[model samples]
Target: MRGLREWWRDLTDLVLPAECGGCGRGRTVLCPRCRTALSGAAPCRARPVPEPPGLPVVHAAARYADEVRAALLAHKERGVLALTAPLGVALAGAVRAGLREARWGPGDAGAVRARGPVLLVPVPSAPRAVRTRGHDPARRIALAAAGELRRTGTSARVLAVLRQRHAVADQSELGARQRLRNLAGALAVAPGGDRLLCGGGPVVLVDDLMTTGASLTEAARALRAARAGAKSAVYPSSAGEGREERKAGPRMAGPNEGGGVIREAICAAVVAASPDSFEINRN
Candidate 1:
């Protein structure tokens, strides 16, 4: 069944041909100009207004505009699977920036060396959306991003451990606050999924784009709750600090302890972020 579907998709692409997802140019999956635009000048911090309580700091490769916006929509909505490689490369750039920000310091040799097998957790797509698209776009991009990371000497791997606890209304027509309300309490870590996060390298939440950041906020909430539960079993004292950190707002991982592990997310990275979410560094 899967093979036939793959064959059919290939046939369709061949028959209709394709244009660059970014520019709509003829006979190319993505043109060079659009590809460069997708990569951005550099990954930079982005935050949504009234950011959700557990939302971690996020980095984005490019602003969601023009070529970047078109490329993302084409891959996500139009099923341009070939664009995943370039999208993943863009995502990898953001991930590297997130990792750099999470580092305690350049001198922390142990933390630097111990950062291995980092987990790339992609946000779960709704089952209905997955069925309609005939593919899980976020997970595919994450897999490609992981490959890109590994090739660049970071031990990264995609771990799709998040699952939707209930159905959500389509977010197309919703405003920011409405989106948050609709997604609240809608995601959770899969059963026994906490084990993957325990004592492993930092887990970075990943997605193709960030709008209101409600989705990533909800995802971090689920992971942090699970991490607190897991930490109580190992480092009971740190549990209080974890809760405190949540109250303070989004935080990246701090210095590592001798035996205790900081299980919270280091940060988040995405291929693109809404233009309004860009934070100018004034200092």
Candidate 2:
């Protein structure tokens, strides 16, 4: 597994840089042109085909292509830490878009705007990956994004309570099912973390990129799996649910009844997603 991980890391173009993260324009970290490319568009639904069962509706600020792809690799694989800000800004946009249309479940209902606090939970990177990179890209970006959202007047914070439960094979070449099986039971919330989520607001799964939606699915599974026994509260899976709950305004659940419910978050956001995933959403 270690060798496979190293081989997969090598597969990415982690070349040392001398130019812009996006278009490699000289004398800039990210040129104006590439920055615009990274965030110029409105977020869109980018659902993977054969979408994993527990995966929620996800939004992406840009397709993972051209400059967006280049920039992501530069920041994540090559450790260009400066890119965290702009990438986070892009992710913030995606989070807003995800919240705007978020449904509590699969029932064509529950679309509430995140007028209050928003919790951004990043998918956990592998321990080995984090050690190799020297920083957790998703968490770093999530913090930047939380700042961006607060600047824009929506109360927000990054809740990095998820952790990898164990190592798995490198997922670079795995099929959708293969990836799912490999990652199944692979993530869990930090001990007592769900206690923080037992109240109000939307909980969004955040990630830098989405290739097959496997990691997000696993993250979601872990969140729902935790024993939030009182209300047994969960935002419930699916993209088209969440209407009445918003109007009723959940309180912390005691057995999900005494206090507010964790806003039953059932949505996600990403900086970029496979261009094909966006295509699937359009059709």
Candidate 3:
């Protein structure tokens, strides 16, 4: 089934060759200039206004403007799957910057091996959005990012364990506060997800773009809830376990041991963030 799907997609692409999503250049999904634009010189912090509670510190590879914006829309809304590779490369850079900011040390083999594999958890897409697009763009980019991370000696893997627990209204027309209200309590961790997060490596939420940051904030909440639930299950109210769980905090711990109550994401990475979020760094 997978092989057939791959062949069909390849054939479809050949039948309808793509132009650069950033520019109108023919015969390419993304031009070199646009790819470079997507990949900023360095990853930088991106914060949305009225940042929601539980929102993690975010890093983005580029501002969501001009070519970057066009490219993201093309890949996400238009199903230009070929753009995933370049976008993933951009995301990988942002993830690396996040790891550095979090003080995970160098990407050397020894350092990465010692730290185990970081988990890239892509923010879940609404069911309606996924159905309309016919593919989950965030997950595809996340998979590519993980591959890119592995090549750079930073052990990483994608864990798509977040799911929407309820429906949400379209967010494009909503203001920041409205978006927050709409998304609150909309997401939850899938069964068995907490075990993966407890694997002693930091969890970095991945997204294609971030505007108001409500989604990421909600995702962090879901993950923390899952961790807490898992810990409670194992500890079962023993005094010693309670003490240990309390000490665990939000830090990732060994799979066998509980990590306490997760309150926020370690960090988040995106292909781009709103242009306004980059202003401080620009100055």
Judging by lDDT against the true structure, name the best candidate.
3
- In terms of lDDT, model 1 sits at 0.81
The lDDT values for all models are 0.81, 0.79, 0.83
Candidate 3 Cα misplacement greater than 4 A, ranges: 1-17, 105-112, 236-265
Estimate candidate 3's alpha-carbon lDDT, on a 0 to 1 scale. 0.83
Distance from true location, Cα of 46 in model 3, Å: 0.6
Rank ordering of all candidates by lDDT, starting from the highest:
3, 1, 2
Clashes of each: 0, 25, 0
Model 1 bad stretches (over 4 Å): 1-17, 104-112, 235-250, 253-264
**Rank order by TM-score, top first?**
1, 3, 2
Residue range with the least summed lDDT across 10 consecutive positions in model 2: 104-113
Residue 27 lDDT (model 2)? 53
- Candidate 3 shows a clash count of 0
What digit string (tens of lDDT, one per residue) describes model 1 on residues 236-265?
676456665555643455433232234345
